[model samples]
Target: MEAELRDPIAAIGLDVEAVDLSVAGKRRMLRVAVDQDGGVTLDDVADATREVSRVLDESDVMGEQPYTLEVTSRGVDRPLTMPRHWRRNADRLVKITLVEGGEFSGRILTSTETTATLDVEGAEREVAHADVAKALVQIEFNRKRSLPEAEETEEDDA
Candidate 1:
C-alpha cells in the first residue's frame, strides 16, 4: 500500500514517510504521514487527503471495506530504515542502537545510501547502514550554537 502511494505523493512534492493500517472495532484506520524538505502544511495534508481518497476510491484496493483515512505529518519514533530517512534526518540529534549491541548518540552530520557520518562529541564517526538496528531522533530544546562551536562547525564545513 505504501509503495502504491509513493509516486502519487511524490508527484505533489511530498514524501510518504509512513503508512499504518489497523482495525478499530468495526472500522479500519488508514493513517498516512507525509512530509517534505521544509515541512508539511495543513494545506498539504488536505491536498494529500484528497489525492489519497481519490486514488483509493477509484480502485478496489480497500475491497469494499469502510475505513477512516487520516493524512498527517509528524515526527517519527522509529528506526531510520531507509537511505531517505537518514537523509531527511540529517543535522538532527539521534540515539542509535546497532545490531551488534553497540549504542551511541550523536548528531547526524550527513548520510549516503550506505553510511551515515555522525558528529560524536567534537569528532566524526561514520557507521554503515547495515549495522544500525534502531535509530530515533532525540528531542532538543534551547540548543545553543556557542561561538567556539559555531567556528568549529564552520571549519568542518570547509
Candidate 2:
C-alpha cells in the first residue's frame, strides 16, 4: 500500500515518510506522514490529504470498511533514519543513541551518506550512520536564530 502511494505523494513534492493503519475496536485509522526538505506546512498537509484520499477512492485498496484518514508532517519526535533526514536537520540539536551502548547530545554540523559530523561540546565528532541506533531532534524553546554571511543584509550606500 505504501509503495502504491509513494509516486502520487512524490508528484505533489512531498515524501511519504510513514504510513500506518491501526484499529480501535470497529474503526480503523490510516495515518500518513509526509515531509519535504524545508518542512511541511498546513497547506502541504491539506494537499497531501486530498491527494491520498483521491488515490484511495479511485482504488480498491481500502475496500468498503470505513476508516479515518490523517495526513500530517513527519514530526521532529521521529528518529532520524535516513541521510536526507540528517541533512535536513543540520545545525539542529539532536540526541543520539549509539548501537554500541552510549548516548550523547550534539548539534548536527553536516551529513553525508555514510556519516554525520556533529559539534559535541565544541568539538566536531564524525559518527558513522551504521553506529547510530537512534537519533531524534531536540526541541529548543529559545533557540538562537542567526543569518548566514551570505544572507546578511548591509545598509545601502546612499
Candidate 3:
C-alpha cells in the first residue's frame, strides 16, 4: 500500500512520513502523514489529501471498505530517526536519550549522516547517531529563532 503511494506523494514534493489504517465500527480510517524539508503547510496537506484520495479512488488497494482519509504533517512528536530528519530539524531544541543510559537536551546546530553537532548549554557537542536511542524535538512556545553565522556576521558588519 505504501509502495503504491510513495511515487505520487514524492511527485508533489512531499515525503510519505507514515500511513495508518484502523477500523472504527463500520468505516475504516486511513491517516497519511506527509512532510517536506521546510515543513508541511495547510495547502500541502490539502493537496496531499486530494492526491491520496484520487489515487485510492482509481486503485483497488482499499478493497471497497468505507474509509476516512486524513492527510497531515509529521508532527513535532515524531522522533528524529534519520539523517534527513535531523537535517530538517536543525536549529530546533531536542531531547536526546542515549543508548548507553544518559540523556541531554540541546539545540541542534548542524547534522551530518553520522553525527549531529548540538549546542548543549553554552558549548558545542558532537553526538554520533549510533549512540542515540531516541531523540524528540522539544516544543518551545517563546523561543527565539537563532540566526545563522553568516547572518550574524552581516549584522556585525552593519
Candidate 4:
C-alpha cells in the first residue's frame, strides 16, 4: 500500500516526505506530505492528492475498505538534513549545531557535494559534512538608516 502511493508520486517528480495510514471507526485515512523545489504549493498538494486518489481507485490498493487521503507540504520548521536542501537555501543565515556540543551561527557562503562553507566572524570556515548535527535557516531582516546631517545637507546644497 505504501509503495502504491510512493511510486506514482515519485514518478511525477514530487517528493513524499511522509505517509500515514490510520483507522477511525469503520473507515481508514491516508495522509501524505509532499514537497519540491521552491517549496510546495496548494496546487501541488491538490494535484498529488488527486493523483494518489486516482491510482488507489484504479489499483484498489486498500482493498474494498473505504478511506480518505490528505496531502500537504512539510512545514517551514522542517529540519535541514539533505545537502541539496541546504545548497538550495544558500545565502541564508543558518544555525548549525556541531557533533561535539557547540553551536555556530553564520551565513552559508557556498556548498559542495560533501561540504559547505560558512561565513563566520567575517571569515570563511569549512565545515565537514558529517560534523553537522542539525541546521536550520535563520530568518533575516533589513534595516535602513538616515544619513548624517552633514552628508544630507551637502547633497541637498549641491
Best by lDDT: 2
- Candidate 4 is scored at a TM of 0.68
Ranking of models by TM-score: 2, 3, 1, 4
Candidate 3 residue runs with Cα over 4 Å from true position: 146-158
The TM-score, computed over Cα atoms with residue i paired to residue i, of candidate 2 is 0.90
The per-residue C-alpha lDDT of model 4 at residue 27 equals 85
Q: Candidate 1 residues 1-158, lDDT tens each? A: 98888899889989998899999788999999998877788999999998898888877878887999999985667667888788888888999999999899999999999999999998999999999999999878878865788788998999
For all candidates in order, the CA lDDT equals 0.88, 0.95, 0.94, 0.81
Instruction: Report the C-alpha lDDT of model 2 over 78-149, residue by residue, as the tens digit.
Output: 999999899989999999999999999999999999999999999999999999999999999998798665
Kindly state the number of residue pairs that clash in model 2.
Answer: 0
- Taking all chains together, each candidate's TM-score versus the true structure is 0.84, 0.90, 0.88, 0.68
What pairs collide in candidate 1? Answer: none
lDDT ranking from best candidate downward? 2, 3, 1, 4
State each candidate's clash count. Answer: 0, 0, 0, 0
Q: Which ten residues in a row have the lowest lDDT in candidate 3?
A: 63-72
Q: Choose 1 or 2, whichever is better by lDDT.
A: 2
lDDT of 4 by residue, 1-158 (tens): 66777778887778777778899899888888787767777888888988888898898668898787788886556667777667767777889999888999988888887889989989998987688999888766773457899999999999
